[model samples]
Target chain A: MNAEAAQPYRLVVVSGGTSDPSSTRMLADRIADRVASLAEARDEKVAVSVIDLRELANEIATALVSQLMGPKMTRAIELLGAADAIVASAPVYKAAPSGLFSSFFHVLDNDLLIAKPVVLAATAGTARHALVVDEQMRSLFAYLRTMTVPTSVFAATEDWNSRELGERIDRAAVELLLLVESGFAEKVRTESWKSYQHEYGSAGGTELDIDLSTDLMRLATGGSAAPRRKP
Target chain B: MQFGVFSVSDITRDPVSGTTPSEAERIDAIVKIAVKAEEVGLDVFAIGEHHNPPFFSSSPTTLLAHIAALTERLIVTTATTLITTNDPVRLAEEYAMLQHLSKGRMDLMLGRGNTAPVYPWFGQDIRQGLPLALENYNLLHRLWREDVVDWEGEFRTPLQGFTSTPRPLDDTPPFVWHGSIRTPEIAEQAAFYGNGFFANHIFWPSSHSKRLIDFYRRRFEHYGHGTQAQAVVGLGGQAYIAKRSQDAVKEFRPYFDEAPVYGNGPSMEEFTKGTPLTVGSPQEVIDKTLTFQETFGDYQRQLFLLDHAGMPLGMVLDQLELLGGEVVPVLRKELAARRDPGAAEAPTHASLVAAKYGDAPARQPRPNANRGDNVTGGSPYQDGDAQAEYPSLG
Candidate 1:
């Protein structure tokens, strides 16, 4: 079935920094490289797709208002959809994730991130906002129902030079690699897909059971019967 | 194969003229567009139901009923009657009355209306939009089929022995098409009930439409309606046609660029290339629309968004003339030529009545004059036709 070509893991990196060479994307790239190395060490062929939010700033804002994604933006969303693990790093602005970064995710299908393993990382100008990675990004991913690794990498301008930042990156990358190999995201979608609530009409992933006892189906058929099975 | 136009009735300023039509003028124009659809030899005219500003079609049945009266052969319908906010009992009564008035030239598409605020305005929760649609449609489906129905549901008040008035024409409920931009479960609901599944094929790319319609078609087969080819499917298309492709684009680009729905997102060329939207010559529209049949596999209905984005009434009529005259006739002949013989035709009042009765005399339910008995017993109809009636159903 062409199994070799289908990488065992797809690690997608979402960099939310507006600046081209910002520390946020650097933090994301460092973690992504570590995750790739760790997956290779474990003999897992992981393909990575990086989506830079800076490139999609206008498209994201337009999609927020227009509800339609242009081709480039749509492809980026598709990559996120196919990812087993995500390295999501956002620059903290006003003690929260960048609006553009959050807007990009807001435009995505709600069920797209469910059960996806994410390595949350954030870069701030000061150490006081370092906790924003967990406080903001983790909770945001939590709302998306994505599983975040315990070790969230937070890099401030000063902390970028510290040994703790590199260790945290390695720790988060190792956790994501473990998760991607576990295949929990695909497993849950394949197994318990109907348990989640999709954005009512977003055409998420699974066909739901229409109860036979529901007044319409009962009236349509004149009695309660078994739910229609998926073919 | 049925071809027609569905209007969102958006009251947008004409980008070229820098003028906007008044609500009254726009409503008048919407009716004119429907009449023009008929004159162009189209099969259907569906209007969307919207409850907000800049969009005028608040009561689609009312407008559709008027269109039904004005036109002879055109089958009038809702692009989607909101299944979420509207009361199921009211839906049953109003649509049935419209059915009688239109003399059976009516059917409808159901959707969980997209607007978020209308939900709260109607005393419903936006969070429970899907459930509201599920439960409300459940009740509405029963009220039309069963004359006296004791119904209980989560969304609204339970009814004990409630009879929706002016029972469906010939006791046949209007046919329904479940219109979904994305929901596979709604597609499942359509498949489970053997109704039509319509994809709004304009906004999204063809791949999106293909995925959703393909799932619906597969499930329609699973539920034993027929083979996948025989599933009743409808697709929404948007076109701005002229004799020459360049002229069409030249005229439509400004409107497309200023379009409230999808403007400012993708370029007109890119949007048209990615989605079912074709702003080109009649020949271009024909070739592009024909690919939809190839992609989605012989769908039953093809409705276009012809009147949105403030295209003037004369221009809309001209496009319809081009569509109905040049494109649809060719499409009808071509699609019909390649149509799967086993595929179901689009449902209509006549077809549904025929399906309900094969060469057998159709029922004409005549209620007895009520004796102060509070309710008529046994069968309310004097003719008492229970031969095809469902038995002991609850």
Candidate 2:
């Protein structure tokens, strides 16, 4: 039996780098592994898929723009959409993410990221461009309406000294796992709210503990925990 | 078996007497060269997209769409599709439409691009290039995979309940090859998605190209796409071929001296020795290219740069015929026979799209329900308040 049966979460790591023993990939793997462990602690089986964008770099543009979606791209996009929470890492290039990473994103439509929670990470040669996750990545995700985890991790060349990289990876893993745990916990509460919606109309009084329609309506709008007063 | 041609679309002076081809003539030459490439039975034909001067293919999709209509089996690709400058939303919809029109003979090479001036020409800042490529591609990937999308990102306006259409024929998207001569990030991006890596191995040595592709292949398997051998690989080359080795060298030397990219660079022999550029007979070019396989490993496609330096149309046509008829067949068989069973074949538009799904139309099943854009005429949603909510942006 899988752990966290009461509430399940899917963890996806999207890594963009072209080295076998890559720091960014190690970061992505650690993030995924940590999230899965947290989910397991709660009796939930965390499903994970790591997508390496380099392997599909060639057809990205045509596949995205073409009227006929290719099979490989379709499968990749499906995996992206099914994730409950995501940890995305890319090596910095020309002061931001690589063209290939962005090309993969450019090929996808906007609807795939609605209300998704993402933890962003970046690897760069120097600390001068470490803020790319915030300056560039934040701006991009903001447009997609994805709820980015407030904390972003940026690692420069100096951050990794063999031993330090392992520790940093561990730290990032913990951070990502915490984010996933919180995200899934929120999902469970929402599910419960949906179940309770049917019970709302039965109450003759307006003193119900939960107004399900209002909660759902709030979620559909900005997906914030706060209730929205309809105009 | 690795033979491909790239069109730079430059109107250069004919070095001997100092006369240049008109832009129109250069563009016309592009078409003729592609036709010749097909006739020569090359593996692929790639046309670059450039908005600035000295280059004519601004709209690659438009040109490729035309190329698809003209040719039967040539694997048409973009030498460089600016991943940083273009919007992913429109990029997705437009390509989907093109896929239907082309019947699967389309793929693209993504690059951040070289001309920094072109960035502002398209209302983008070159400073934000890396971020733009990252965010925009994330959204584009989703558009292709998901039936409907609601996204918001930094680079473009938010998409609310959006679905890019027409859908890819058979719900399969084209294969992607990340073309890069320098950046390791591009290679990483290709690996991240299990896509192909094309080290435009034109100017560089086999050693440099090897490192970049090897980097990509390693990450590809590390991310669990497949083994390193299954990673799709392509490369670009430049060559001048003739019947005899000395004759080829003597003829191409003048053109090489006058070449814009290499004009001030090393001598012809020195340059060709280090790079993939070969000035030799058909057999010599074959020998040089075949040796690349041992260095780069089994690659899928090998595209060559043939039509440059104002080489006469008649002479260029002759080179293609010699390359296609005399050399390609032998190399193709040799490469195929040597490839391991564990290796994955090159993924072209027709083959990959067909293998994944099928040859089909590039239209969505229900175009009306979520006709987000390009739904102005004959849309059922045109009735009443629905139109107000989703105005016909067309």
**DockQ winner:** 1
Model 1: lDDT of residue B307: 89
TM-score of the candidate numbered 2? 0.59
With a 3 Å backbone cut-off (N, CA, C), the pairs that clash in candidate 1 are none
Which sections of candidate 2 miss by over 4 Å?
Answer: A1-231, B353-364, B369-394
The worst-scoring run of ten residues by lDDT in candidate 2 chain B lies at B379-388
DockQ of each: 0.23, 0.01
Model 1: runs farther than 4 Å from truth?
A1-9, A18-22, A35-48, A93-95, A114-117, A124-129, A145-147, A156-231, B120-128, B155-163, B370-377, B385-394
CAPRI-wise, candidate 1 is: acceptable
Per-model CA lDDT versus the true structure: 0.83, 0.71
Report the C-alpha lDDT of model 1 over B1-394, residue by residue, as the tens digit. 8999998879999999999999999999999999999999999999888888999999888998999999999999888899999998999999999999999999999998678899988999998787677667777887888777776656678676667888899889999998887665677778878888898887777877777677778878988988998899899989999999899989999999988868877778767876788988889999999999888888888999988888999999899889989999999999999988888888888888898997897777778788787664445667653222233656
Per-residue lDDT of B318 in model 2: 86
Supply the DockQ value of model 2: 0.01
Model 1: lDDT equals 0.83
TM-score of each model, in listed order: 0.85, 0.59
Worst 10 residues of 2 chain A by lDDT: A199-208
